[model samples]
Each structure stands twice: as C-alpha cells, then as structure tokens.
Target: MATPRIDLTAAAMLLGLAAVWGGSFVFAEIALRELGPMTITLHRVGWAAPLLFVLVRLKRLALPRGWRIWGSYLVMGALNNAIPFTLIFWGQTALEGGLASILNATTAVFGAVVAGLLLRDEPLLPRKLIGAALGVLGVAVVVGADALGTLSLRNLAQLAVLAAALSYALASVWARVRLGDQPPLVNAFGMIAGSTVLMIPAALWSDGLPDLGLAPVTWAALAGLSLLSTVLAYLLYFAILRRAGAANLTLVTLLIPPFAIFLGWLVLGEALPASAWIGFAVIALGLLVTDGRAARALAARYFLHTVTKE
Candidate 1:
C-alpha cells in the first residue's frame, strides 16, 4: 500500500508547526548561552509538561493508567524529546542555527526509509527517495550549498545533530506503531511527562543547579522554547503524525527553514535574497514530488494537451 499523504488541514498544521519549530533553533541558541544542554533540554520538556496537563484537563482527556503505555511513552519521550533535545542543544553550541536546521532536515529522508522498513503499510523506498533527495538538496541550497561542507573538529556536533534527526525519525514510527490507540493529547502529555521525569535527574547530575538569576532575554528565550516550541509543537506534531503518517510528517523539517526565512521577512521586515526565494520554490517542488499528485496533474494537462494538438 502507498503511504498516506498529508491533506490540506494537515499541511496547514505542518506549516504552522514548522514555523514554531524553526524558532526553536533560535530559542535554544539563546537559552544555551547561559544554560547547559541538559538543563535546556530539561526546561523545554519540564515546563511544557504542565501546560499540556492543563490543556488535557480542559479537554477532559483521560490519562493513561497502564504501565505498558507509560513505558512506551518513556521511549517516545527519549526518542522525541530527551535524546534529540540534548543532542541538538549541544550541537548548536558549535554550529550555526541554520546549519543545525539543515542537518536536522535529514529526518525527512530518514523517516522515509525507517517508516518503509518498519511500518508494513508505508510505501516502499522507491516512491519516497526522489523527494527525500530533493528535499535534502533544497535544504542545502536554502542554507547555501557550502554549509554542509564546512568541516572542523566540530564534525562531532554535525554527527550529533544527525543522530538527533535519526531519533526524530524513529520516534515518528514508534508513535505510529506503539501509541496509535491513545489520544494525541494523552500521548503528548505522557511523552512530555516521561521526558520531564528523565530530564530532571539528568540535568541536576550534569548541570548541578541552574542559576536562578537569569538574564531577561534568556528567560524570554526559555519561555518561548517551552510554551511555543514544546507545548504547541507537541500538539501539532501528534496531530500531523495521526493525519499524515510518519514519512509525510517528517517533511515538516524540510519546510522549517523556508518558514523561518519567510517569518524573518514578514515580521522583522528583513529582505529576502534571491536564494531564499529560490530555495522556497525548490522546497515546494520537492514536496510536490513527494506528494506525487501535482506531477500527475501536470502530466495529464500538458502531455494530453500536446498529444491532442499533435
């Protein structure tokens, strides 16, 4: 069976999700200036957990009581939050936010292959690879082709971000297979709670105690990271996962940088360069290739029109 594709609703949610998540790199960059990777990771999942809890209460979603489900939640938390968050935070210390985001776009390709292997219903490799390749090329172009070629001792940091991308890919597939029966809200809560539990101790042991007298800018960044990026992002993420399937959901990574550039242009009145607009076009083309619908429509229109005229 072909893998499920994202609908318009899912696509809009994904664009919004990508926009918020794009800022996470900036937020983590700011927050990491004063905080350890562990503490930053902790703060993200820790603070967001309660906000999700409040939302859950308002929605009257029942919390899962079973240990088995919680266990799966723990794994989800590790893959989706704890591991990736820590790695990316650390990786950003040595890499530019754009470069890190570029590296993270590998999630689309990784998700495509991983879901194909693990999810029986997802499409085989052939259909997804064309788009995955172009999505990656688009990311590299968006950030400038030279970004990926920058080699320093921080090659480890690049590896770290790539690992985080892989974790994200795995988390997408795992959520589909393991937590498919649970409500998205419950799964969001349980996963955040599980990460919070794991993070608190790890942070304390690694970072000791966070300095309470943080700069206001740092505080603002932390709040943005937790409230917008984590809280809202989790909700949108699981919604996309449920609606679009794992492979399509991961394409959000490819969309992130474009939205980031667009937001800068729109909100800050920053001018977009030729490359930025070109990159966005390329990214859209890649997404179209992945969806496979636009290509069919184009072929039917132009090819058939030409044949009829001939």
Candidate 2:
C-alpha cells in the first residue's frame, strides 16, 4: 500500500489547528492560577460540548446513534480530551508554558511510532526512526543536561506532559481506525460530549464544585480554551485527519512549540534559554527527515541521472 499524502489545504488547516492548540498552553497556565486542573478540563469540555452540538445542528449533520458509537466516543474522549487536558494542565502548574509545549511535541514522535505499529500503510521507514531519535535528542537538549541529573517533581511533571502527548497519539490512531468515515463535526461533538460526562465528576471528586466567582481574566481564558482550542480546534482536527493520515496529522505537534513559545514570552513573560532554540532547530530538522520528501526527491534526481547516462 502507498503512504497517504496530505494536500496543501489540509496542511494549512493542520497549522491553524496547531496555533490554536499552542495558545491553549498559555490559556491553561492562566486559568490554573484560579482553578484546579480537573476543573479546567471540566469547564473546557463542558463549555465546548454544547457549542459543538449547536454547530452540528446548524450544519444539519446526523449524529451516529447507538451505544457502540457512543462507547467509541467515550474512549476517544478519554484519550483525546479528558485525560490529556487534565494531565497537561497539572503539568503546566509545575512547568513553564514553553517547556510544556516543547514536551507536548513528543506527540508526533509517539504518533509516528504508534502509526507505524498499528497502521499498515504508514510504515516506520528508516528516515522516521532517525527523525524520532533526533527529536528525542532535541527534547533532551531543550530540557537541559543538568536538569536530567535529578529526578525531581518537576521532572515527573514533564513526564506527565509526555504521557499526555502519548495519549493524543493513541487517540489519533483510534479515531483513524474507528471513526475515519464519520463527519468531522459529529465526531467532534460526540467526543467533547463524552469528555464532559467524564470530566464533570472527575472535577467534583478532585476539586469540589468550581468557584462561581472567578475573575474576568480567568473566565476569558476559559472561553478561549473551550471555544477556540477545544471546539474549533477539534473541528479542524477531524477535518484534517480525514485528508491526512494519523502520522501526517501529528506533524502539527512539530509546529506548535514556536507559536507556544511566542505566546508564552509575549503574554506570560517566559523566556527560553539558548539550548531551547537549538533543540527546536534540531526538532525541525527531524521533522523534515521524518517527512521524507527531500530524500525522495534526491533519489528521483539520481535515478534520472543514471537513466540519462545509460
């Protein structure tokens, strides 16, 4: 089977989706000051689910019925939204926004590995393995060698964020295998609705009832996280997933760090060290390697030269 390709339109949507998700780290950091991690996850999916339902209605899209479909939605919700969102928010409590985003870049690494194992068409090429190694090296560089010497709570928090990325990778593969044929809006709606179901009780058990007297800024962040990041982001996510396979969709993770770093610096005054920049460049090179287009072009050129010489 041939490798799936992402068209330019889908690629643009993926970048837009990455920007929106990158901004979410900043928003989560802001909201964490006023709310617990579970509370933030609750409100994000709770608020987004209704809006997505309304969008489904407006589009006159038919939602899939029956427990089997809803069950799949529940699993997708856990992997995609509830679990990852909560973990990332908790991790952000201990990590800078840029660091959290950089850790999240592991989603592509995990996705590539997961897709290679589970997806027949998107095999694990030698380039992908080398790229993943480079990506891992880049992450270690960004995190700094000194920091790795101690296994502190902060390192654990970083691990949690990495785990969240892994969850996202799994969710992408699950969606491709199970709901690839479903409408993007419908899948988005169902997943968020299912997330709300899981998150509401989780919030109550972990954080008690949410405070109704949050400051205006916190509320604004919540709205941005729910509306732009969760709702609209997932709409774009499923749309791109339809056009691009899971591995391609995960490339958005590679684009997220820069947007996140900029927002963190501008809004939160979080400054990154030189190592982080070097690591980001390494990660970018790894992504290019993972893409394999340059290697393919080079091979084509060599083949043409040989043909002409012959």
Candidate 3:
C-alpha cells in the first residue's frame, strides 16, 4: 500500500511554530532587563496557568485523571519548561545576547544524541549523525572563537543554559516515547503547572515584586514575552510535536538564531558583528549539510529523475 502524502498545512504550522519560538530568546532578554530570571519565569508560568486552565475547560478536555499521566506532567513540566527556562534567563545575564541565542541552538544536537541513545524507535542514523555533527559545528561558529576563553562562572552559566536546551530536547523525545498519545493540553498543563509550583519560593527569594512602574516599553515587552513567547509558543510547539515526529520538530532550533538576530537588529538596534554574520552563514551551511537537502537537490538534478537510454 502506498503511503499517503504528508499534510503541507501541518508542516507550515510547524514552521510557524518554529519562527515564533525562535523569538523567545530575545523576549527573555527583554524581560530580564526589568525582572530577575526567577521573577520572569514565575510570571510566565503563573499567568499562563489560569488562562490555560480556562482553555481546557472551554475545550472540554479533561485534566489528566490518572497518576501516571499526572506524573508525566510533573516530570515533563519541570524538565521541559521550568528548569531550562530559568537557566537560559539567568545565563543570558552574563553572556552576550546573540552568543546566548547561538548556544541555545545546541538543542538540536542534543536532541539527536538523546533520541539516539534512549529511544529504540529513533536509533542514530547516518543522516542524524551528520546532522548532529553539523549542528555542533554551527553552534561553535555562532559562539565565535574568542568566547571560548570566557568560560568560567559565566561559562558555566552558559553551559547551564545549554543544559536547559538539552533538557528540552530530551523532553521532546521522552514525551513522544511516553506521552505520544496524551492530549497536547495535558502535556502543556503539566509543564506549566510544574514550573509554577517550582517557581513560587524561588521568585520570592530572588527579587521582590517586579517594578510595574517601568516604562511602558517594559510592560509591552513583558506582555509579549508571556503571551507570544511563553503561552502561545508552548501550545504551538506541542501541537507540532503531536502531528510531526519529534525529530522533525526539533529541527526548528536550527533556524532560531537567524530570526533572533533579525529581531534583535530590528527592535534593539543591535548590529550583527562580522563574526555573527560568518557564524550565521556557517550555521546555515551546516543545516543544509545536516538535512542533506543540498545533496538531494543535486541528486535530483543529475541522477534521480534522469531518463535512461532505451
């Protein structure tokens, strides 16, 4: 039996999800200027909760009724959302925003490794191995050669951010292996609820109430972060994961740096350093190599569709 064609709309939706999520790093940077990492993460999880709950009620989707599902929610919630989100926010405090965004791209490399190591269904294939290698090289280029010396406490913080990326990558694979059949909202609520529970005391200890008195610009940034980056991003992400395989969905990270750098240039008036431009080119090349799209196009031109002599 012939396999049916994949839904192009679904692929486009997944791509849109990727673009929105790519902006999250910039949003985090904006929120961190006015709010501590814990505070920023707290507001996002807490504010989104009630809204997500209401969404569940409106959709008539039951909360995970079983402990098994609940446990999945808790574990996934922490790994997928809370811990990593907080790490990236704090790490960015010390690192250059662009460099931080570039480092975060390592999630694709980590995802491939994690999926290959843990998931029986997703063994490491030649393409995956090549893709993973290119991704790592891309990340290296994006971080620049000089930043290697900056690794210390700040470097450790950057690693923590990368760890967060790894956690997110692992969570994607884990959810597919474990919660593939669970509702998207359930997975979302789990992470949001778990992150909220974890952020409470941390928020209190890190900083007192975030100053709402900041310029309207700050408030606007906060709203943008919470709504577009956090709330909507999560929902769109899991929806994509549900439709496309996790492996396919995780490639979104590859494109994140470009969009992030573009937003930074447009909104923050930041110029892309020469190194950043070179890094961007390297990363783009790596993605092409990793996916074999370049090779595939060549094969189609020279080999695959060519007519043979009768």
- Sort the predicted structures by lDDT, highest score first: 2, 1, 3
Listed in order, each prediction's TM-score against the native is 0.80, 0.89, 0.84
Best model per lDDT: 2
Stretches > 4 Å off in candidate 1: 1-15, 132-151, 236-251, 261-288, 302-310
Global Cα lDDT for candidate 2: 0.87
Taken over the whole model, the C-alpha lDDT of each candidate is 0.80, 0.87, 0.72
Q: Alpha-carbon error at 156 in model 1, in Å?
A: 1.8
Q: How big is the positional error of residue 169 in model 3, measured in Å on the Cα after superposition?
A: 1.4
Give the lDDT of residue 118 in candidate 1.
85
In angstroms, the error of model 3 at 171 is 1.2
Tens digits of per-residue lDDT for model 2, 214-234: 999999999999988988887
Clashes of 1: 0
Angstrom error of the Cα, residue 202, model 1: value is: 1.7
lDDT of 3 by residue, 1-310 (tens): 4332226865786667656666676777777777888888887788788878887888898776777877777788788877888898889787655666777776766676688888887777777677667666666665656668775666677677778878888887868877778678866776688778888888888897666677676666667767887778877776666676654665676667777777777776666567656665565555555556567779877764565532
Tens-place lDDT per residue, model 1, 1-310, is 6567788999899998998898888788788879999999999998999899999999998897878999999999999999999999999888666556666766665576778778899875565777677766665565565657786646778778878988998998999899989888888899999999999999999999878899999999899899999888878887888788865775776678766555544543545457645655565565567667667788899999999999
